[model samples]
Structures are given as C-alpha cells and as structure tokens.
Target: MIALVRHGETDWNAAHLMQGSSDIPLNDTGRQQARDAGDKLAAERDAGEHAWSAVVSSSAIRARETGELIAEKLGVPFIRVYPQWFEQHFGDAEGVPVEEAMRRWPNRDPEGFENDEQARLRALGALEQVAKDFDGRDVIVVAHGTIIRSALMSLTGRELGFLGNATASRLSQGAEGWTVHTFGGETLEDELGEPAAEIVAEVEPA
Candidate 1:
C-alpha cells in the first residue's frame, strides 16, 4: 500500500496561482495542516489501517517539510527527496493566476507547459521506483497536487480533480496491478473506470 499525500499549502496556493515547479515554502497554517494530517494518519494506523515503513517526498521544500512532520508522528524514517516526484513544470504560467492562464491558453496548453501525458508517465515511473526501493512495505509519498492527481488518473483511469492540501489518497499493489482505494478522500469502487486522459482545462490550480 502507498499513501499519496499532497504537500501543505503555500502562499501561491492560497492566491490560486499556478505553483508548478516553484520552490515556495509553506505558511504557518500550512505547517499546522501538515501536523494535523500526520495526526490523522497516526489515528488511522492505530485503528488498523496499513502501517507505513517510511515517508518519502518530492524535492520541493514544502513537500520535504510535510514528509518530515508526518515521519515524526509515525515514528518512521524520512527518506531522501526524489526529483522525479517534482510537480509538473508549468512553463510560462508558473506564477500566474490559474484563471488568467486559462484565459490566455484556452486548452491549458501554454507555451512550454508540460503536457498531461508526460506528467502522468513521470508520476507512474516515480511510483514504480518508490515501490521498488521499499519492496514489500507500505510507504507515504508526499508530493505536489498535480503530480499526485496525474498518478491517480493513470492508475485508476478515472477523471479526478484537484487534490486538497495535505490530504491523502491511498493505493495498493497486488499481483495483478495497482489498485486505487481512494482519491482525494473519496472512496472508489473496485471496478475500474474508463481512462479519462484529458486534464480539465478550466480546472483550478493543481
């Protein structure tokens, strides 16, 4: 089992800005949110949820801090950062408001913006790598919202929207393949849905 968690909020997140690949730090509220999320995860584990062996995170400072806080609560090791888990690169739209960017690029395909397919593939590859590194053990992966969303879509073939700050989505791997248990707190049925490849253009920030 793998628990995919979004990093806590940053100023850019609060402003509805595109923070792809940006190295923004979390605010005080964001820090508290991380701790609260950790507490919740601990409670879930105590209630017989899957036990995690380690906490891994993206290279971004915000993600690293979130993972560290969760590790402290779970009494697990905080593994090194993985650049492969970095958020999708937004190109010229990185710091712009999501609405403004959508207006400028109706299809959300801005110049130099990383395409959804690439992000999805990158996310899948990262998941495989992480699973390999911690073979036979469940782990927590703290990453940005966009990449996490991409992974969920690719794994479950469902149309998922934005993931909330510090929220977790769970996945389990079996002999057949990866199975999505929940997405952004919504429990999913075991049946797989049709693949929804297109990322919603008018959607809000990742």
Candidate 2:
C-alpha cells in the first residue's frame, strides 16, 4: 500500500495562489494539520488498517515538513525526497492567482507549464521507484496535490478534485495492478471490498 498524502496548507494556498515549484514553507495551521494527519494515521494503524514501513516526501519544503511531522508521530523513518513527486510546474504563472492565470491563459495551461501527460509520467515513475526500493513494504508519500491527482487520474480515469491538505489517498497493488482504495475521503470499494470501478490503466514498474 502506498499512502499519497498532500502536504499541509501554505499562505499561498489560502490565498488561492498557484504555488508550483516555489518552495513555499507551511504555515502554523499547516503544521497543525500535518500533526493531525499523523494522529489520524496512527489511529488507523492502531485499528490494524495498515502498517506503514516508511514515510517519504517530495523535495519541496512544505512536503518535507509534513513528512517529518507524520514520521515523528508514526515512529517511522523519514526517507529521502523524490524530485519526481514535486508539484506540476506552473511555469510563469507560479506566483499568480489561479483565477487570474486561468484568465490569462484561457486554456489554463501557462507557458512552460507541465501538461497532464508529463505530470502523469513523473508520478508513475515516482511510484515505480518507491515500490522497487521499498521491496513491497507499505510506504507513505508526502507530496503536492497536483502530482498526486495526476497519479489518481491515471489509475482511476477520473478527475478527482484537489486533495485536501494533509489528506491521504491510498493505492494498493493487486494482481492486475495498482488500485485506488481511498481518494479524497471517498472509498472506491463496495461493501464486500470489490472495486467499484475497474482501473482504467495499469502502471508497469520501470
């Protein structure tokens, strides 16, 4: 199982700014959110939800801080960062407000911005690396919302909206391939534990 956790909030996030690749630090509320997320994971672990072997994060400061807080709470090791898991590049619109960017770039794709395909490839690559390095152990991945959403979209073929700060989306490896079990607080399974929808794509480890 790989738990993809969106990093906690930042001032930019509150202001609806496009903070791609900006290296913004988390705010006080963000820190508290990270701790709360850790507590939530711990409680779930106590109930035998899953055993997390390690915690990893993106290279961004917010993600690193979130991973560290969660690691501290879970008593798990904080592993090295993965640059591939960084948020989608917003290009020249990095510091602009999302609405204004959308207006400026009517198609909502700014110059030099990473497209969906590229983001998906990066996300898949990161997951493949983590799976191989962990040797089938469960891991927690602290990353930005955009990249995580791309991964979820690639696997589920559904555009899951923005993931909340410090929230977790779980992906489990199965015979067919990776299956999204939890996403944005919604379960992708029926009461009998069967997947509600078939996975649209299977990612082969590189």
* Predicted structure with the largest TM-score when compared to the true one: 2
Residue 22 error, candidate 2, Å: 0.9
TM-score of 1: 0.90
Which regions in candidate 2 have their CA more than 4 angstroms from the true location?
Answer: 189-195, 198-200, 204-206
Backbone clashes in model 1: 0
Assess the local accuracy of residue 25 in candidate 1 as a C-alpha lDDT between 0 and 100. 94
In candidate 2, what residue range of length 10 has the lowest lDDT sum?
A: 189-198
Question: What lDDT, from 0 to 1, does candidate 2 have?
Answer: 0.87
CA RMSD of all predictions:
5.8, 2.9
Cα error, candidate 1, residue 143 (Å) = 0.4
